[model samples]
Target chain A: MASYLPTPDLSHLKSADYHNVYEPAEDSFLLLDALELEAPFLNDQLQPRWCLEVGAGSGIVSTFLAGQVLGSRAVDFGTCFVVTDLNPRALPVTQATWARNGLALHRLHCIQTDFIRGWRPAAQGFDVLVFNPPYVVTSPEEVGSQPRGRGGIDGRQVIDQFLPIVPTILSDRGVFYLVLIEQNRPQEIISIMRDQYGLLGSIVAQRKAGIEYLYIVKFSRDTSTT
Target chain B: MRLLTHNMLQCHVKSCNDPALNFPLQFQEVELEQIEAEENEALLLNLVGKIDWPALVQTTSELGITGLPPTKPDVVKNDPALMKRLHEILLETNVAQGKMVCRGCGHSYPIKDGIPNMLLAEHEI
Candidate 1:
């Protein structure tokens, strides 16, 4: 079995914080596993300068990315990790998470904004982007109503809204990692990204988490066509 | 918030997207604090390529904390004094309590407990 990156120390997070923020779950770990699997590529080839994590609830994913993926080589690669979330409670939780792991505050920045809204045209050229959006199938009203695990109808509302902007924000060598459930039609998402946006995508990792099947999809610009 | 974060942030208010006007939100009534952190010289040097030095200098000056040169200095690696100063400005200083006023829209985002509230109201969103 391949050794996985150690999970960030989230011991500081109490039960109270979970009430408002999205707790790290199976899906979150799956994303972390995928990032770890790609660590060699990320650190050696990509050498991402700016990394952004959308909807960084609990901030475990970004924290892991900073501490594990990039922290191992912090001196050589000065990657700035930026995370954004709509929840007011998540900002502080993320800060604490990073601090507990001994990561520098300057290396990680947290902003409370709705799906990259506050970081519009100015927040482009991201070398790496990761999002574990609300992928559970639910009513549209539940998308932004609460903190986490709620997605609108078919669970694609947030995913759909965020997909169009991926090509724009990503740098020429940028790569994006997104988490999805079986019900969300991962194939269709892959096709849409490849055909419409000219970005090629593939299922980098997948696991059966109880009744739900989780998939980690990675998308990058198709240099062949571009 | 650290000056490194401030370097990347810009006013995202609707109709304030212009690059020239949106950058480096002006600090207002800020309560700055310092917390000691492990110093990593290589990391600080790496950040120089991505940081907007001019904006950082101007913003820190506005906050009444002046140490960064008007221009980004060359030879950040060999100069220990310069590296120490950069380390403090980037990692040590934090906005414990205050708000950042957007240069373009004049909207204020509050900072409490060192976290900047970037959430905008429905109209702004």
Candidate 2:
């Protein structure tokens, strides 16, 4: 596969940083690839002003959007990127990742909060929102120890809660990209988003990375309805 | 947190619902810094549509940032000067270290190293 955009430089993150923040893995890159596929539509059509990564860990995904997807693919430098993480340590790590990548800070901001509760966007809403959740299936007990590590019961714990809020968080032209594993039941999630929330949902791309059947699910406003 | 981000933040405590009280989280003991960046005139014009003009005025006044007109200025005018100034305050000014106190719930969210922590306690949630 020919790579159109260069991958973001996350070399600034040290080994110790991974202790608290999640290290970029196959899942992160897959989300980046999915976004890259939509770069044309995003830059040309949507031209999102406000973007966010719900659980930006090492900030690799956000860095990719800021540097490669939004910045280089087009000249939309004004597009603001907001990164939020439940883990406090992830905040600084994500900040450092963007800084090391030479991204301008005027459009990059970080906050610590759970979900979109802390997010307070106006009518424009989040034009592009991405979340690569913890899709490793594990017992409920495991979820407590690792919030971003394993999803309790089919890795749907966080994703389920996050699904309902997508419509509310997204703008009329906004599109959301979410990553999930096979155990996470991607089809069912798509239906729930469409039927329940009035969003048009579908899997953009799915690839098998190692043993995990990674899927990138995209949800956008159902223009047909209105 | 930048002024643009702070403008959107509000008191989301489950019990706090009043718009007047919840919104425009008050900055306290803030360590402000000016981090320069390339100016984007189009961005400034685009942001004007959604930015809370009144809230921005109140915030700037509260933070002792003067010279801003109470109403939203015409960044789209022939003058590039207003756009540059707004680009600085709205995007460049950083809230390095401080706490944002909610006018309604009296909840305080802390800011350290340019990131604001809005995670509430279980009870607050």
Candidate 3:
């Protein structure tokens, strides 16, 4: 069946809010499309119990996943959705997005932390993880600077910091979806996940938007018994 | 703050690393408000496995709201009344105003206008 999850009502967010928090754009919608493509697998096969969205800006992506994919299940599957962002202003916006979608705050949690630095109780790894990192190639100093969408030299600074910890933070059957541009060296990232982390990576969806070719790369632990 | 959000939160203070002291931050003073929301039993059941039931029970008790059993009952799936109560605890009840105090470090995080202030000082970060 074609996925028909309604795009969340973000009309509640005003331009003033967008000044600091990210406005939903093509990159965000592309991530939503990728998730929609895998909705059936996520719903029936994975039955994901815990989902984490890193750098959840407008909170639209994670909200969609909770409201559309998992929420469609007949059983009260109770998926816990947690989101983290470096921008403190993004937390409230994320919460508003959740409220706007008729989803309560009970199953959703938002924390204003940088790149999972304070993540403790390591044993409680997530079953589904998604990240739409800043992949624009820019000066190194711009990585964490104000207007926080710049990815440092090679456009992989944030991605690099998050990659090594994937295996450690993911459950045995967990799947991670990440967004990257061609400039970020997608092949090297796929290789690193395979050769170093023992996780298989593949591009699940890609689209050329303007000058940037965006890809949604999905990774999971290599479970093939060969 | 919803109990679901409270369930995942821990005291992130730098010196407060002890697990026992971190979780289920004590709700010192809270203002409760109920907002109507669409009921979805499937979503509620989906959340049961992820919630720390005992922590939730303790939090509700501390907040002076009781009726949750000491532990999560296996019959929740068969009991609609229990499921409805769970829905109220998790989704309907909101912490409108209050402060969440860390049990270990004794740091207080305030809630204003239904939003919890989780930002820590530079030294805490």
Could you list the CA RMSD of all candidates, in the order they appear?
Answer: 2.4, 1.9, 3.4
Q: Report the lDDT tens digits of candidate 2 across residue range A15-114.
A: 8777787877888888888888988888888888889898878888888887888885424545777788888888788888888988776767788888
Q: TM-score, chain A, per candidate?
A: 0.96, 0.94, 0.94
Q: Write the per-residue lDDT of candidate 1 for residues A26-145, one digit (tens) a residue.
A: 898889999999988998899987889998788798888888887767546767778887777787888888889887777777777776665545446889999998888988877773
Where model 3 places Cα greater than 4 Å from the true spot, the runs are A1-9, A67-71, A74-76, A98-107, A115-125, A145-148, B79-81, B117-125
lDDT of each: 0.82, 0.82, 0.80
Q: Give me the runs in candidate 2 sitting further than 4 Å from their true place.
A: A121-124, A144-147, B74-79
* Candidates' chain B TM-scores in the order shown: 0.92, 0.91, 0.92
* Model 3 agreement with the true structure over A1-226: per-residue lDDT tens digits: 2337778889999998888887887778888888999888898888887788988788899889988767645235656777888776787888889889877676676666665544445335788999999888999988772345889999999899899988887888899999999999999999999999999999988888889999999999998854
The global Cα lDDT (0 to 1) of model 3 is 0.80
Give the per-residue lDDT digits (tens) of candidate 2, residues B47-88.
Answer: 666678888889999999976778875544566776777788
Arrange candidates by DockQ, highest first: which order? 2, 1, 3
Task: Pick the winner on lDDT between candidates 2 and 3.
Answer: 2
DockQ of each: 0.52, 0.67, 0.32
DockQ of 3: 0.32
True contacts kept of each: 0.64, 0.72, 0.34
Clashing residue pairs in candidate 1 (N, C-alpha, C atoms within 3 angstroms): none
Best by DockQ: 2
Pick by DockQ: 2 or 3, better one:
2
